[model samples]
Target: MSPVSETHLAHRLNLRLNVEPSEIGGIRHTVIQHIGSWECAAIADDVILVVSELLANVHEHAEGVCELEIEHQDEGLVVKVSDTFMTPPTLGHRHGSAETGRGLLLVDALTDHWETTITGTGKVITCTFGTPGRGISP
Candidate 1:
């Protein structure tokens, strides 16, 4: 069978919110709403989850404000989460008694691709998930 054609668009949404602990869910919802009309709902959800984790981390550890920018691509959505915290995120080992270090770990598990870039202001964690047609069948 031929490769399926996928709907695609590239745009960016900026989320500005207080780094207060309670704002993480709002950030996630913002992302979901922004991506709702895309044909890649599954990928959108994955990106939303990753974005949530990163934002939560900022709320728990960072200061002042946190921002998120999502770029929708043909194959997937690219998510970037930035905060004032200069320290890199810790992907704590869950094998032990650690109950609270799995944010980035979850991002790793959910996204098909991800990476972190240290910016002049802070670090931006980028993650991506493939849309339906981009899936490769074995």
Candidate 2:
């Protein structure tokens, strides 16, 4: 028998999380469990942080539920976190010794490709991280 190809193995998982103020930890653990199943390398670890930041942002500012969608492509995993916040995310040093304000910056540092798109109702932050041995630098 032959091993399954990476392309055949990477699976896509999508999640919608409420922007509750206190569920960030639970959300992060859920994402880790879901994505960690994949044989992808450090990509899972990188994604865990990204999801935490994204969800934290949503809980802090967004007014409605936050949606998190993850698609595992042949080359890597694509994560999209959408919220109904009107203000755009600015990547810079956090205001001060604040515990927050640095989520987006962290995402930028971890992911290979990332972008933000504004929609009629809100905004969607998308990031992609490459898998370990599949020719990516996760």
Per-residue error (Å), model 2, residue 46: 1.2
TM-score of 2: 0.79
Pick by lDDT: which candidate is best?
2
Cα lDDT tens digits for candidate 1, 65-98: 6666777667667777777677877665676667
Sliding window of 10 residues with minimal summed lDDT for model 1: 1-10
Q: Give all candidates' CA lDDT scores.
A: 0.67, 0.73
CA RMSD of each candidate after superposition: 8.6, 7.4
Q: Give me the overall lDDT of model 2.
A: 0.73
